[model samples]
Target chain A: MAQVILKRIASGDKSAVQDCLKTYGGLIWSLARRMSPNPEEAEDAVQEIFIDIWKNAARFDETQASETTFVAMIARRRLIDRLRKINRQPNVDSLEDVLVEPTNDREQDLQVCVEAREAAAAMKNLRPEQRQILHLSIIQGFSHQEIADALKMPLGTVKTHARRGLIQVREFLGLGSDFEKEATV
Target chain B: MKDLQDNRLVELLADQSFFGLSAEEGMELGQLKKRFPEWENDFSLELTAAAIGLANLDVREDLPANLRAQVYANADEFFSEGATDQEVFNFAPSANKTIVSPPGASVAETTSGFSFWQNLGWAFAAVAGIALAVNIWTTRFEKPSEVVKNPETIQMPKPELTTAQKRDELLASAKDAVQISLTNPKNEKEIVGDMVWSNEKQRGYARFRGLPANDAAKETYQVWIVDETQDSKTPISGGVFDVDGSGEIIVPINAQLAVKKPKAVAITKEKVGGVVVSKQENVVAIAKV
Candidate 1:
């Protein structure tokens, strides 16, 4: 179905572009959510991704790859682009981390979008911003500027939101042995 | 096991990175790291429990950058004019208006006019045909991917003794002790100690302080490496002796390898110079570490 939509889009059918958006809208939103610092930045990333998909859909070679692969490549490219931008800022690690487990739901959600609903449902403990910040900073790597622009707030406001958000996460971890209580998280 | 680096420890404390570690859990990690010497041996269970206790305070700040659309807006304008370079024909801004198509026109009428339709018809047809033909031409584009015939399962190389590699890997995992703790069956409380690891010898040394004070020695407290690798084997000798005014003794290790990775560290009572394994004077009171 994505293949047909993309082919139609490449064939210059505007409605096919709309159809692609309709079907893949949730997928793109979830990806943006993973990448952005908050819901607002996610909203912006979603818009940017869609506009990019529409404009570049002509280059999509349907026979060369599946539509999911094509869309995923675009999403991953945009995400890595964001990561590179963040990497330009001061970073915490130059070496690769050796941890093996999927420490959070964002990883599971990113690997499988269909699982996001289940993951979100299972996210009983994380507060909204705690989930939002982890999704944005880790997955999206959006800078404070992008977050500020999306949120339409002062730079300090965005920083405060992120700082306060992390405190809540620390609070959750303090309450119990989250590592031992793996089933609950 | 390799020594945990400070930066790696910081990463472990980050929420995105080590979500598995709770704040209280991270506290234990931080506490041990703060107290232990930068490079030392004895990472006992007490240290781990202590690290877990301090886990609750770790926090990370990571965010994104600016996104401006002017560059994109310009690109959109360029592409809408076809893939042709707008920069090339800037002199003919008015001329572009002459070629604009009517809002509504029949398909036949649209193709009826101009040098573009008449002279460029063959070129258009050729491009379209090529576009369509490429699909047919590469009929077998899905040709079987060349398979690399490398062995799927690689056997792990057996560990070879290299004084250099051993020293380095140990340096990565080892830590230095800050204080020493020692106790005996009589003075079972208040044992503080410092530890160090020797990769070349495959052993760790612990120096004791405030240990059981013996007078001319009937018997002294012994340190043993509770060997965990050999089926939770008996506690093996790590040199033992009485402490002087300084309360210091260097113990040679046989199986403190368990401390590098183990359930706990057990202190036992024994004769001087130590024995091969924990005996009748076996494990006095084990430190939970």
Candidate 2:
């Protein structure tokens, strides 16, 4: 098994610090810049996110997720918290512009984890509106209201689409075991 | 695990992972979380979001070289095993400034910032110690300074010091100052910040990074200093403040009553203009001194 950088970090391995930074730094930096309103905020968010990562290094469970996924989870939570705190949505492309573009034709340079690839495939299986709503909410960071206004759908409808679409996606990603296990019990 | 079993919880969790939740929804989710203790973490859906976000990230930009260097330096200090309590709190003695410890305080009391990490569910509390002298000094020293025309003094452009800079200055000037990190005691783990208090100066400041901005008309954050000299049930009101923007915010602590010995500092969400005394509910963060 590959040594988890976070576990190494938890053990006070100074060398894992560099490895962790090198591995997830770009991913976090990109997420921050995309989610933040400005470059300076992005930089600050990056620092705070790194601090959170370091603090949470001991909590990383390899049985639950890959290191990249765990790091991404932390980064996303931090970014969302930041957005909620700042009362700002991600400075992403307009809904119209993004809707016109092919969502799958993203930059290939960034590494995609297995879950994300499966998520992408699952997204394709969603209804058009559901896919679009999920895309707007997850990728573009649009609030339900914002998505409703953009898509000219009712707010409740947008939320339903988002929730239902997400449930489907989660199930497709093999994350529906919670429900399955509970049902059997 | 029970989240998926309950449709409402699933909906809330899904909303949380996607574009986030409304204040009402968040409260509901938090309430629901109490019913399901096995819900160890809320980042499961966020993990899915991460995968999608990673798959679709427009560009993979490299971490700035300067940021990389800063991270390494901080990590070195943070992970250093031999660092003292002061160093852990980032309060090294300045070259020109003399170090003076706060009276009747020990190293253990001042260095409780790291305890937040070790102990989960530890409620954050604010500063303490109600000094009667602070009240007398304020009342007796109400004199306006007469402007003396000094042409010899160079009127340099004085750059406004940031809240962070002011915090550093307070730490440097007040040798007896205490700094503590604050965190949320609830399901939301993103809220984290620090409080710096100086009993001698009777002045303090709270700095927060992830505290949500509030609508001034609807709600505001009120700070409270739990003075050991006073009743544990009733803390000294540290005035009300608002977070207007993102990133680090520094709010000066405005203690209504003189604080002599603060055992903990707390911030609670109150109605507009704040209340005379908080019901000890809706507390956002607290730093146990």
Candidate 3:
């Protein structure tokens, strides 16, 4: 698929960009939105993602991953990188929620709810602290020691939580044990 | 590497923030991965890990048209002018550019020849255009200012928005629900979102913070208000407006008129196409408003 896009792009296929947007806009938007500080930022990130996609269309490798995933990953990374300059706040209790204007886009709402529920259920397996730690360290990607110092816990405790937390997550999904099995160097 | 029993390393792989790990941290994680092979290659966990960070957050798909044009204009100027593979996105210097121009293509088309690059260019261009369009489509057409040049040429109303205008603004802003979290404990640093339910302000707004910086060009969070007033089923729109993106801004909410409290308040990721129904994800931050 990427090869087709690459070939087509190489051939000056004008419609290819829209096709890519049609195909992966949602995925890229999702990934970019995660790292966006706010809606406008996310919107801007989407624009950048597409720009980067077009600029790099010649380099897409279909063999490496799905084109959707590839572009989405690129978008995801760009968003994350953009996020780095800003202070990595743990989570701001949404301040303006009290007055948020209601929208009428129901289907989109339902879709987001469905996906959010799935993601939330996966998160439910995590203990509140585990979830927080994971949110800070993994999702937000903080160092263990860094997390340890922030949370003011022993380094060992942080490690224990991460390991046991991961093990528990594996169990929550009802998978085999030994989730942290050794890797081949 | 075998004895890399550092359990802390295992935590890094599970972190969505693993992309920014330092070299020492990376080495440490790599060692742990050698000891725990599954850590580096857990697809299911990675999916969940990735999605979890994104959960409860909105992705904006609306691109203003002008921004799209600006990017395209720039691309044409810089990238199009260079016949080299510089447009090719190879992080490494040695990567070759792919040229897939269809047969019988003229050299004039060399700039956007790759059928896919053209698509790629259009996609970006689409976002820029959307941004411009959004800016234009958004502003209510007010009467243009008159009087050539007197200091007071224009009659400035003491108050810009009349009561009716204010109501209209509110109605417009009420068109979409801004995701918010009134219940979250203050001072918490997580990016908690909730629904914004109001009809006396702009047509759109969101109460959000803690998100990392990223381009939000064609992207905008939309409000979805479900109305069960007249009918037992089906929720309708209030209105739609792009997020101010400076923390939060008022947007019109759209739901059954006169219904202060709609059945449900929700948000969706809308497209530059501005569809009545969004074919995208919603953070699903449920709210009583």
Candidate 4:
């Protein structure tokens, strides 16, 4: 039974801050670099991301998601907000490049987190086009239009694939029912 | 129809989670939110993307050493005892320069030292305010004063004192004044300034030699007085001012609320007109009491 870093951070445990930085710094740094338009913005984003992490630490519930998933989720939210504020899109690979490459180049490192492993397994259930669209849009930070243009597909079709792919993943991760229960309540 | 709309809501949420929404889609989502308010906090796609992104993260490059230190420094301040939860923040100080009151001066000596300085506040305010009002009224309604014989006799005007001079006079006179140098904690370039406060007078002033000027349209400098009387998290805002020029400048502290025993004064760059509570991310300079 390991201590939840976020819970400790919420309680103002100084050592937990150190542990959090050590554990999630790389993940967040990578996300920021990929999502922000420039290094300076990335640096600022990281600082603000950590602040958001601390502010939202008390809300971290281990039962809902793994620590890695929770940290990544928080980082994504801030990065997305920053992107919207600046009205700039992330630098993304051309659709052809994404299509030709190995889908899971870092698959070996996927075992580092339970949620990642589960997500990787769940991604296999989507249709090939849906999986590719999700990878381009979600993992590579491409917009729906960008993905549609890159893939030479209709925008509506791209949106459908992305939405269905995410729904499939949500179900695979056993989140759909919980979400439904919460929504109905 | 209900099922189709529910699906549309899910589509919008999933799209928003992935790459945000276009203006039209955002409006649609806002309308749908009214229909399905339960999904307001729903972040399933975001969580899915994060999980998938975690599996795909290629460069888990460690944070730069300098950046790591900054994160720790920020945490120290964010979690500092009695620090308020400010969503907006400024910079930090690399070094603290505290100038305490000179050794063992009695209340009698300090009180005598401030006699001229104490009266100056009242005299200066009354003269300036009344004179300006009179000047404006006379110029607008009546003929201006154009006397020839002894112009100086009609208006016995004292020389206007610059803010720097006022600050200097206060420093020379107030024996209990605490002066602390303010600096940028995270950067190499030094932000030169000193914040001075007198516990006896409950007055303070800030002087900066080379602080950068700010755009009032975008942001302004806000002063904060951290004291023992109130929670450190919600330090009294000492009012907002702008640096419209390049050289040395002095600003009078107009603490919107009184502080009894101030432990520190800080200046943060904030949105135009300043914020009621700062997040402190943009704190440019700080002086410890």
Report the C-alpha lDDT of model 2 over B1-289, residue by residue, as the tens digit.
5534466776677778876677898888888778865554645666667777666553344665445544443454356435554332221111000111123322212122434332221111001111221221122222223113432211221233555786888899888999898878674354489899988666688999968889997888888898876556556667678888877888877564446778988899987756544676798897789
Candidate 2 wrongly placed segments (more than 4 Å): A1-3, A89-98, A106-109, A180-185, B1-5, B22-24, B80-82, B85-289
How does chain A of every candidate compare to the true chain A by TM-score? 0.49, 0.84, 0.53, 0.85
Runs of candidate 1 with Cα error greater than 4 angstroms are A87-100, A103-185, B1-289
Order the candidate numbers by TM-score, best to worst: 2, 4, 3, 1
Q: Cα miss at B83, model 2 (Å)?
A: 4.0
Measured against the true two-chain complex, the DockQ scores of the candidates, in the order shown, are: 0.02, 0.18, 0.13, 0.17
The digit string of per-residue lDDT tens for model 3 on A1-185 reads: 53376445545554454455445555565554334444445545665666676666666554433354345445655565565544333312222211122232332342233333354455567776666666555443445655666667787787667655655554454333254444211
Alpha carbon lDDT of each predicted model: 0.38, 0.63, 0.43, 0.65
Clashes of each: 38, 22, 131, 20
- In candidate 3, stretches whose alpha carbon ends up further than 4 angstroms from where it belongs are A1-14, A26-34, A38-44, A51-70, A89-132, A135-181, B3-19, B23-48, B54-61, B70-81, B84-289
Which docking band does candidate 2 fall into? incorrect
Q: Looking at model 2 chain B, report the run of 10 residues with the lowest lDDT sum.
A: B91-100
Candidate 4: tens digits of C-alpha lDDT, residues A1-185: 13488888888776677678878887788777666544445656787788789888887767677877888888888787776676532222344433633235447763448778888888887899988888767665667876776677899999888877887787788764454533210
Model 2, residue A173: distance off in Å is 1.9
lDDT of 1 by residue, A1-185 (tens): 65687667666554454356546654555454444323333434444465566666776654333455456445544544444433322111211111111233233323332222232333335555434443444333445544455445576565555544443343332322333223111
**Candidate 2 lDDT score at position B36:** 66
True contacts kept of each: 0.00, 0.39, 0.11, 0.45
Residue B133 in model 3: shift from native, Å? Answer: 14
